[model samples]
Target chain A: MGSFVQWLIESMFLWKALIIIVIFAITLAIAAYSTWGERKVAAYIQDRRGPNRAGWGGLLQPLADAGKMFFKEDFIPAQADKWLFILGPCLSMFTALMSSAVVPFGSSFIIGGKEVFVQAIEINIGILYVFGVVSLGVYGVMIGGWASNNKFSLLGAIRAASQNISYELAMGMSIIAILMMSGTLSVREIVLQQHGGNWNIFYQPLGFLIFTICAFAECNRTPFDLPECETELVGGYHTEYSSMKLGFYLFAEYINMFASSAVTACLFFGGYNYPGMDFVERQLISGFGANAGHNVATLIGIGSMFTKILFGIFFFMWVRWTVPRFRYDQLMNLGWKGLIPLAVGNLIITAVAILSGYKLVGIWVGLALMVILISIVWSLRPKKKNAIMGA
Target chain B: MQNILNLPPIWYTFAILSVLTLFGALGTIMSKNPVHSVIYLIVTFFSISAHYILLNAQFLAAVNIIVYAGAIMVLFLFVIMFLNMKEEADEMKNNKLVTAAIVTALLLGGILIIFLRRAGKEKVDALGFNSQTGMVEILGQSLYGEYLLPFELISVLFLVAMAGAVMLAKREQGERHF
Candidate 1:
């Protein structure tokens, strides 16, 4: 029995299980707080005092919201496909949770003479895994909308499917530049490559912009939240959803926001890689012993990662409140015409830069050329005279 | 009991996945609703991806899920939903068509079995397998270095297909836009 206990303690799988649980809990906590944060941000932006009555500046508001959601009536439409209706939110929540598995939350720590990574799993094809999971996320919304047997819900689902498919192309193309630069698909390697402020954002600003926009579209956040646009498609895809089912759908969105922010930070903004990380690591090592210092440094990295992710969440909310949602045709035009061509151009520039062994110079020059070309096209374009203004 | 317990975990995983794959395939064909059929097909795709992962082909697994289960299946669901196919009206009522389908299915199954049997005759050293062969780095190296032409050709083919689709979908002058 003692030996079995010892073995369990020493087992890698056991440690991994513990780490997974911790990460899952942390993800849920963050997602819950993000709802509160969104409300606060929205209120502040609109010049209102948001939910301060709840524990300490609305800290416990998410809990109250969850409780209320739980107590609400769980209504399934008479015509709704019951199983698929339930499966919709489950799949959404599942995919949203699964995408975070490969994200390296921080550097590894020395634990029990073993190097324990902060990430849940470190797959070689991390980016593709995330992409696959994200792609699967559409089914949740699609299935829910369809099963609702409502015209407005069907419209919302159709809009979501097309939007996701369109933006995914540009998103994949934009990431190719980063893949070329990093030369690895693993999120850990990508983060490590961007150590000490040598971030991808500096070199691939245009690609980052495209990626960020695609990320917004992918998460179905504002400007791209056409799927749930309250103005037109009343309640949109989740029009028929009620109680905990609706809660699950809403919770999944927050989780997706958190996961995408983490991915963006890791890919471009130098995830967990603060400017003085190396210096701090060195100082800690000198002060404390090696293992302890390394562990502390890992903790600090985790802190930095969370900070960036929170800022990303804040940015999401900021844009949500600030930008007006695009018209359907305008959204399609921006995705297909604007982003795709730009991403392809960026890809070509990246390929050329890498081939010539002058990545920085080549990219900047290419960007300049693109800007000039755009300006020329803008100048040559036909302008319509406004009848009202008599231009 | 000891012998059963001593079997590698992969064997158990393979068994479960094989069962899932078969179940999903059967469900796809048998389900009444087209949307349900699509969902079942997605399940089959996911199981196939798991099989790929079991073979240590992580990249292929990811791509399989991303392409088949993700994009293609979503499109399938979208079309099925848009058509609002809730009835059994589309089901084949002709006995001739049923007989033809059965014959085709049987013939395909027979051919697949023959091929599998022939392939199984070749010796495989599971212990000596090079795990690195399935890694993305090696896959990339071979794709660009050795099979570059075929890769480019495939991409060009896709581009042509995309252009054909666009051309087919394009609105002619004086046509109703909707």
Candidate 2:
């Protein structure tokens, strides 16, 4: 026990442990409040006053929500497997939190004469790690739905599993383009490579579009939320769940949205990087001390990263409210036929451009090709049958 | 007692992983429910992936989780759920079948033990833990350079299998479209 404590102290494990707790708590808090945010966003979109009765701007609404969940009776269906019934939500929350371990939130800051990276863990294969954990998110839904012992729940789970499988392919292909361009799998390395004004969105715009659409599908957001569409499945996978277990499933969705948004910001946007920040840091250092300048830069970087994440979340909500849910077949069709081919084409173009040393021109060429392909698909779509309409 | 305390961490990890892997594999066949069996199989895969991580095969560990536990096992569960195989059908257990199962299991175990013993004899000098072994760059180099022909052939084989599956699953013109 003494030796173990000594090793822990020598490795500075306490700092990392503290960071993990902070990140996990912040993630859960954001996920909880996102429900309120969603409701407010929906109300604003519909031109109505939103939740404001709890506290100032309904800031205390999430607390009230949690209180209600805790007070509600925890339930398990009579015929359900009790253990798996409980394991579902736990798995959901676990996988949702696992993906954030490798995400870099800000630039390195000096503390006690040592540089500290603003990530829970700096794994070598950061992008792959995220993909692996996110892919496991399907199990929570599948197990939960199956254990519910309801036909609707089982159907919803099956649909979710297949949807995840379909979309992950395109998402992975889109990321492959960025991987080729960045030439690294580490999220921190990707962000550092995109420092200043060299965000990947500029170079891989088509890939970013494909990735964003796939991200929406993977998160079960609007246009791909057939699994839980209220009109069809009636709460879908969580139809039989009640109390905190139900809360866990819903909270997991918001957490997934948050994590995927952070990942998108890190991959496509400049993660924790702002234009002219280096110059600002240099001037600040010349005027003040080195540590103060670095602290300022790191603070601004963290703020910028959070801003990007919040905006991404808002965009997800906005799209959810605006666009209607897709038909199940249409969702699959879009994933397999539309996004996969586009991602493959984008990847090929990116590779060719890299090979030919015309990287900037390559993006433009990719855009042109996508536009042409869209037009071709649009024109080739079968026209409505006039005779049936007339009859 | 001192040696036990001084033992490296990976040995403990390996012990735990081996136990978990064995339990999962046994549970997979012992479970009555097909869904439970698939879940057990997933557990087995996870323990194996953990073992890979302990061996510093990070790439293999991630791929193992993503492809096997995440994708393939999910599909297995989906099929079982779709077919609504909630409980296993009761069949008469013959003594012959039971004996055959036991003999087959023992034979497999024996083969595994033989391989394990031979592995110790033919063991190459094990390299110390190095970050380079797990990086994508080195893995890619070996895969593309030393194993390129086998890799391409395996991909082609997968392509053929995919085409075969598609051909077998396609509906005929007379069939009702879902």
Candidate 3:
């Protein structure tokens, strides 16, 4: 027991534990409030005043929403599998929350002459850890759909399962290009490598594009949200769910969005690395001494990281509202035929470029390849029948 | 009490995980519903992955969950759901089949026991248990260096299997050959 306590103290300081709890709470709060953000964004886009009744500009809207969910009568279908019906949302929320553990929000800062890494956990295989959990999240959708005992729900769940699995291949392949360039799997290491404005986006812009698109598909966002298309499958897998159980599914999606955005920022954009950060750091160190300046720099990094995450979320919302959902066939074709082949080609080009010691040229090559591929896909795409000249 | 307290946390975790894995495996075999069986199998895989974590094989642990619990079990669930399998009735019991099952179980147990006995005779890897063993870099180096041929061969095997699966699933134009 003493040894365990000693180990815990050594491995995780009181400050670290507090930071983790704070981050966890913040993540949940963000996910809860993101619903409000989404509605507000949608309303703004559609030209309306969105939910301003709960508080000043609907600041307390999420709380009211939570309360409503709590007060609402919970309903379960008569033929539903009780165990799996409950397990579904719990699994979704659990996996969604777990994926955030690997993300590095900021660089290390000195506290009591010891360096503290500002993230929940530091694992060597951080990227893979997130991928594994995200992949596991599909089970929640599958189980929920199956347990619902509704045909629509079942179809939606199967579609979601296949969709997530298919997109994950492209996502993983695209990430391979980033991994090759960064030469590390640890999220912190990747972020650190991107310090002083050497963000991975510059080197692997094409990879980033592929990753972002695949992320949308993986998250079941925007044009890729065929699984739960309201015009077809009514509420999709959550058709039978009511009250907090339903809330959990929605909340899980938001959390997944937040986590994936953070992951993208960490992978592509400079995670916490701001441009001219070294110059600022040096100036600050000379002006205000080392430790204090370092603390300030760390704060700035955290701020920058959050900014990137917010923008990423905004991009998700913007795309969601702007782009119409793809047909089911188009979704599969884009994933399997479009992204996978492009990702593989990009990865091969990256490898060859690395081998030949022409890393900068590799980025241009990747961009050219992506453009060519897109054009090829565009030309080959089955043309939509003209409305005036009926097919 | 002092000795119990002095034991490392990993031992306690290992004991709990081992028991859980065994229970999950039993449930997998004993569950009447195919979906329930698949879920139990997933639980078993998860516990085994927990064991992998305890052994400091973090990469293996993650891969195990991703491959077994995530992908493979999902496919299993999909199949069971697609079939819409219900609880099976006890029928078509044959003496020969029962005898064959018993013999197979006995043989498997004997082989497992022999392997365990042989393993027990060797020195433990405790002295060589470096935390870095599980890092992606080390794993990649070893896999690409010493295990390159085997890895390539396995990838080729997977490609073949995938092609076979695609072919099997493909619809035939000429008379719908089974």
Q: Which candidate is the best by TM-score?
A: 1
- Across all models, the iRMS values in order are 0.6, 0.7, 0.9
Name the weakest run of 10 consecutive residues (lDDT summed) in model 3 chain A. A382-391
DockQ of 3: 0.74
Off by over 4 Å in 2: A1-9, A373-391, B90-114, B127-131
In model 2, the clashing pairs are none
Query: Which candidate do you rate higher for DockQ, 2 or 3?
Result: 2
| B-chain TM-score, candidate 2 | 0.82
Which scores higher on DockQ, 1 or 3? 1
- Expressed as tens digits, the lDDT of each residue in A326-391 for candidate 2 is 878778878888899888888888898899898989778867987898899888987777744222
Which stretches of candidate 1 lie above 4 Å from their native place? A1-7, A382-391, B1-5, B94-107
- For TM-score, candidate 1 versus 3, the one ahead is 1
Computed on alpha carbons, the lDDT of every model, listed in order, comes to 0.92, 0.89, 0.88
Q: Fnat of the models, one by one?
A: 0.97, 0.83, 0.73
* Model 2: residue A122 alpha-carbon error in angstroms: 0.7
Candidate 2 chain B lowest-lDDT run of ten: B85-94
Pick the DockQ winner: 1
